[model samples]
Target: MNIKDYLESGTLEAFVLGSASAAEADELQQLKVKHPEIGYALDAIEADLEMIAQHMAIMPPPGMLERIEDRIHELKRHPVAERLPDQLRDHGQRSEKDKGQYIEVEGASSHMRIHKIWRWIFAAVFILGKIFLGFAIYFYLENRQAREEVKELKREIRQHHTIIGQQ
Candidate 1:
């Protein structure tokens, strides 16, 4: 096999980009060990890809790393287990002081509360939709009537032509 042709076949690029098939990857690995030129070419392709990635990389916003580190520290200080209610941690057993401390949330109300402005907007939209529906129905009926009139006129014209031809 010609090493130059193999190198130029883009197999090295595919392998570096993780698009090479398992068989192709295995073959390339074996060849890399046997051929020093393949190894050098593979290394060169990887380095070029890395350099391109570094050049195209975007810098994170300021204080992003610090915020992430601070959040990690906060989580460490107050772990998730410590945040859980005593009832949950102690298998449904609650202390006397914790009994009436929390309100039992029941999904009793099905109505959703919306802002007054939104309610007015929704009403306006509903009224407009009904008006548009009325206009659409009226136009549809008018169009149907026009089509029927046109058909009748055509029939009359055909009758007049037949009568004239007979004369």
Candidate 2:
């Protein structure tokens, strides 16, 4: 029989899986017996599919399995604790006096990071404020110069009118 034609027809899929009818299975067994190549093809397909399945399976890291099991048990026992990951966790895993020190270190690290961020924020505000202040000063100086020019023009006009009156 045409093995290539049979595989292409998708009949081999059902045949390989034993999903074929009893008569079809018997026919496939006879074909396998006649052609060892058919058996090799089936074996290769199974191996390839198994490899693909394994490649797709991404197992979680260590302690994740235990955590997942704990969560499952938690859902059954204490539903409320499941909501809070921090509260449910045991600090007993931590040392006694050192736990406080660790807490302090964590707090300090967080606090320092916060302070550093704030410092940058404050510096940015200060720089922006200085820019605005400089703009205000520039506008103020411009307005003052304009007022002085107006006064000078008035004085010059007054002088010209006085000379005109004298003439």
Candidate 3:
């Protein structure tokens, strides 16, 4: 196999991009060892890809890294176990009988608090729903009355036709 043709076949690029099949990767590894030119070509392709990645990389916001580091430090100082309530932390000390017992938790307030704007929006939606329901009922009654009038007119027309036929 021509090394030049093999290098130009894009196998190196596929391998570097992690898209090469296992067999193709194994062949590449063997070829890379036997031929210095294949290794050089692979290295060049990798360097080119790295350059492209560096050029396309986006810079994070200024304080983003510092904020992430600070968060990590805070978590390290307080750990998850330290943050748990005293009752929850004493689980291991409880006997088998006490293990089956449930822990009672108390909250400061039973009511949920939402944004003030959301309350007004919900009230508006409720009023609009009532208005739509009233319109629906009104239209339904009107349609029923219209149907009754149509039936009465048809009956009268039938009777007039019958009387004329008799004459």
Candidate 4:
């Protein structure tokens, strides 16, 4: 195949973007091995894409790197089980309903795990909630006591008025 025509056909672009079909990728790899020019061209295109990306790069929000590092650390702390890749998944193992679709994989634990910081925060909140509940109950009892005293005072006033009228 003519090198110029192949380059202009956009196969290289498709390959770079990972949109190339398996057959096309095989052909590209073979061509790259046989011809030095194809290899050079692919490298050139990749560099160009990198340059374009650098020029178009936007600054991430502040502390994004810290958040990302925290997440990486979290993932490192609790290692998940290795999954069978999509291509390597056995079709025989899949049910008839799941043949065409992706299947969900179970993790090591069914329960959700949280960060240590969150556990502390949750404990603090729970303790504060209990304290507030205690305060509410105390205030309710005090109010009830005050209401009973007021009723007693009203009864004493009525009894005094009857005594004064009789005299």
Q: Provide C-alpha RMSD values for all models, in order.
A: 18.0, 13.9, 13.8, 9.4
User: Clashing pairs in model 3?
Assistant: none
Q: lDDT values of the candidates?
A: 0.86, 0.74, 0.86, 0.84
lDDT of 1 by residue, 26-141 (tens): 99988988899998887898899899999999999998898799768667865877656568879888889788787444333453446769989999999999999999999999
lDDT digits (tens) for residues 51-83 of candidate 2? 888999998889888878866865676465444
The whole-model C-alpha lDDT of candidate 4 against the native structure comes to: 0.84
Flag regions of model 2 displaced more than 4 Å: 60-167
In the predicted model 4, the residue pairs found to clash are none
Supply the TM-score for candidate 1: 0.45
**Angstrom error at residue 13, model 3:** 0.6
Q: Which residue segments of model 4 deviate by more than 4 Å?
A: 80-167
Q: Considering only N, C-alpha and C atoms within 3 Å, which residue pairs clash in candidate 1? A: none
Model 1 has an lDDT value of 0.86
Question: On residues 70-148, what C-alpha lDDT tens digit does candidate 4 reach at each position?
Answer: 7687577655433554434563565566667765555544456578799899999999999999999999999999999
Ranking by lDDT: 3, 1, 4, 2
Candidate 2 has a TM-score of: 0.34
Off by over 4 Å in 1: 74-167
lDDT of 3: 0.86
